[model samples]
Target: MEGVVSVNPNHVCKLHTTRSWDFLNLTLKDVGSPQESDVIIGLLDTGIWPEHPSFNDTGLGPPPSKWKGACTGQNFTCNNKIIGARYYNSDNSSDISDIQSPRDSIGHGTHTASTSGGVEVAGASYFGLAEGIARGGVPKSRIAVYKVCWAFGCSYADILKAFDDAIADGVDIISVSLGSPWPSDYFDDPIAIGSFHAMKNGILTSNSAGNSGPNPVTVSNFAPWSLTVAASSIDRKFVARMELGDGQILAGTVINAFDLNGTSYPLIWGGDGANYTIGSSPDIARYCLNGAMSTDKVAGKIVFCEAGLDGSGVLAANGVGTIMSDALIVNPDYSFSWPLPATLISPEDGKTVLDYIRSTESPTATIFFSNAWKDVMAPKVVSFSSRGPSAISPDILKPDITAPGVDILAGWSPLAPSTVYQDDTRSTLYNIISGTSMSCPHASGAAAFVKAAHPNWSPAAIKSALMTTAHVLDPSKHEDLEFSYGSGQINPLAARDPGLVFDASETDYINFLCKQGYNTSTLRLVTGDNSTCNNIKPGRGWDLNYPSFSLYVKDGEKISAIFTRTVTNVGAANSSYTVTFDMPPLISVTVEPPVLVFSYVGESNTFTVNVTGPVISQWPITSGSIKWMDGTHVVRTPLVVYNYLPGAPYNLDSEQAYTMTRESLGLTHSNVYHKTGMGQSRAHPQFL
Candidate 1:
């Protein structure tokens, strides 16, 4: 009992699973150094494909002297680059098809592991698409794979055990691309519990924000101890072009690898093949649900179907391809990849396709292979990346930052199919996928990048560097503001040399836990020490020395809160930083000291931010920033004030929140995710 930490009933968590380093202007030449090779990144996911070129240790030195991990599973080999390998299935519920070894059978683990600290593989891609040199943000960093997920979903028992092992294994950082379906108490969540220990051990844990998004209060992995990452676009976008016989061209956001060899195929509306005799409705056929379409009619035709539908019927009926018309989340729908040649177009374009199909006696169409298009309006938080005002801790922001997560081409396991569909026998060594899972590893790599440059920095210090030096995002592009992308998209180059950091220690976090309402007994279970709440009232997160400031206010109540923060100078000695702020006209914010002058590096400075505003009735949330600028560096901290109205139409209480699904969230891209609970093609669950 004395040795045991907190215990919880087993709960299942699902797996979640990048791109453009050039978009961040991070070239290989300026990226890694000998110090980077000393850092080790531990990944808790499905597993890894060590045989892949991404794990090659060619010309690399042996593991560091502090390395204390080993290869603990069969059928897996670890090199200097991947110094550790272990697997867990404490639930004993893996499918018979699943291999118990650390070798990845689901591509999610391999993809994420490579995205975090993979060696550069030249000319890597998925079927020649997204072709480029595949490398991680910290390519020289070592990777330690801890297989915690499986076909039956990741059990909390295994997840916790993994954390126990990884933290003791001398890992510098932990990357987890998995989460539970819903928010739970900090003590009840395995990630929150695991990461608390990781933080105490001077290891930063990077986790996914989840795929449930375009919806408020859906962020997962929201604990303050972990770095929750959101998915965002890079400069590249994939589009599948459709050419109609009438000389009209329609482009849809998708990843279609199959080529028709420039030949056109007959096109037909999915509704035309409805099995009316079997009580199948036109809507059912139009959506292309299985058993609704007649095979004879749709075979060899490119079926036109409504978007957000499984469209599995088309494949089942031997249809060559599909054209999906998506009406929701327009301005180019979420990009997805299916086994067959397919494309997802806007509803308006779909109307044109339907018209051509109905008017032409013998309609014809062609879907070209997906091509990469440059998107100028990128770095936008993706629609699937979870939104925040954390369901667990609303006052403290979740999704600490954003990273390149969409359409990331990374290492893959040949044991798994290229597509999520099991029917497709295609296999590849590199695949493109999207999720906060991908983004978490990117953040992990960035954290390692910073750790390499500042080896003495703590986990909180590394997180502060990443958050303060991030690239600012446009509020106009995101509806939820900071809730959508956290501080901003990551800037690995700038993060390495952040002028200052807001570092917190184990004692500070214990105090924060007390403020969050953890009693003495519960605190001891978590901290493994006799820590007391000391009569601290449960309240907003104003005391934690976080890099960002966020206040949650009631809808009608006056917005008045004071935040006291401390910054540690890690830049040039004898430098001074003058404070500047940009806030809305309705809000008044002031800092006690106008400037901070540090006579030497590692010197600490304290400041207090006082904000007062009239009741904000028209706006749900308003944001500003506090910048401490010197001639050489600018340290930025985002400020967010949200009027969170209880029992609002969209807000859900803990008792009522469990029932809310992506379906309830209204037309979230249901087909895109690749959960451990694998779906039958375009029907994956939201957790992964």
Candidate 2:
């Protein structure tokens, strides 16, 4: 928490507008109930923008009786909806850009807070795009802003202070959209420690699976007590088209608010107008770096810059427009509106554009903005969303689930620049941003929605409910793996009544920490208890009573891991479930006590799963599932078997290779295999 961390501005009340509500059979009417109004979500981030329309409390009453926090900072006041506001800056480092107040200047905390519990705002849009009645998952829920992040980054000291206060203030759910760049030990991780306390206090914590993704072992929030959320795409996407002078139109992705009025502009390559002041090479100038382009040459002409170039820099040089290429092929479905009209094309299309520019004496193109599109191939996991094989606890899946994170339109701060540039003066009440940061709030809102429905359920029970009832599907129709999506896309309504929940108590997590090698001193620091690991035997990581099953097997090693889990019946009392399982190749799974009979609600049943697998060469991770099927419900848990060698051949350069690794061990694509410098074959996987 106390690192050079950036905010996760990753949504829209587009919650109900998108397939999220319909997919889960949830309605705005259901979310606006009185029970939901009692739920308070503690947002730990930059802060909040109290005046935003989404935070309006016209219909809300006074703060819940359990609230104990207060509004801090000059002129900061909380309404019925935004019941509490507090700021923490223990590092005491004064960054010029950060305002020393509870009011949000970065826009991330405001956006996420509103996304989790904002009221409905009619005609909500980001500069007239994605216009709809924007609201959070549980619109009546209250918000308590805990300012822990600043311009420099979130500090570990500040995060802990906020967590302590927020829990004492009686927040039912904690939504943390901040994370470190890499995995760390639970004792050293601020988020892990803070969430542990929240879990102990019965507050569910939903966290972002860091944006450093599409890579293995990049997940930052791997704590079993927290709901680690991944980002995915919704059906709606924004697209821009480039109409060339030759009557051929090339389709690219961008949010273009500027209109050219059908007039075409002369397109010039950045290399042709290279400025020597910043760099000597015209090739480097093609990247459109600051001072790399000649103002006189690029002025009044559209410039085509390479992938790494900052489009805003070209605009600052008086360039009329930009045709930018992707640095990497991310979610082609998602795009952002720059300060000027720009189109982001894939590298393949970029090559074609370059060829056309070189072939013609004069090249001109017109960029046309398209209305929002609903794609058939949506709900695909965005390439930027972090993947898992949790680096901290390999036995547990990191991202508990994915949510709509790509091109999300949510409430924004009036103080923050719309284009994310310091010089840009444009501002809006709502903005579209993407990241796992955005996905965290969506899951947080959903968790709040479930919490409102079942107020007595424990945090672990709620997390288990979301994971068990989640929809399992990969980006492609084929090759669904838990490493990328965990249990899968969340289904909030289904989660409210997840027939059975893998409930864990504060003691269970303490046991997990004990097994993680935390000594008595470290355990005391984390739990604030005089607890010793003396009585607790070191438990297996796979036996943490989590909703999903994960096992790590090294290459050529035959190992068997047994996981003990307990499930509590939350559904009908007279229920009987038969355990059914699917095994991955090379791994055999068996559930002891194959059938469970429950006589009443809250009846608990314990089961043991024995998994035996041989590490298959070239295959890193493979997945299957175990389901408890009664006549009324099918409680399913994804079973992930990872053959993780310190260094493995499964790492490939393309996304296709990763997909192939999950689907089958055979590699039919030649691009996956590369000759190494040591004259040996290697699989060069793409890292974010």
lDDT leader: 1
lDDT of 1 by residue, 256-368 (tens): 88899878999999889897878987887888877888888889999898754444678888999999875553564346677789888878899999999989999999999
Count of backbone clashes, every candidate in sequence:
1, 5
Encode model 2's per-residue lDDT on 370-463: one tens digit a residue.
5677767767776656677776567777678888777777887787767534445788888777767778888999999999989999999999
TM per prediction:
0.94, 0.89
lDDT of 1: 0.82
RMSD (Cα, Å) for all candidates, in order, is 2.9, 7.4
Which candidate number maximizes TM-score?
Answer: 1
Where is the poorest 10-residue window by lDDT in model 2? 675-684
lDDT of candidate model 2 versus the reference: 0.75
Each prediction's whole-model lDDT (CA): 0.82, 0.75
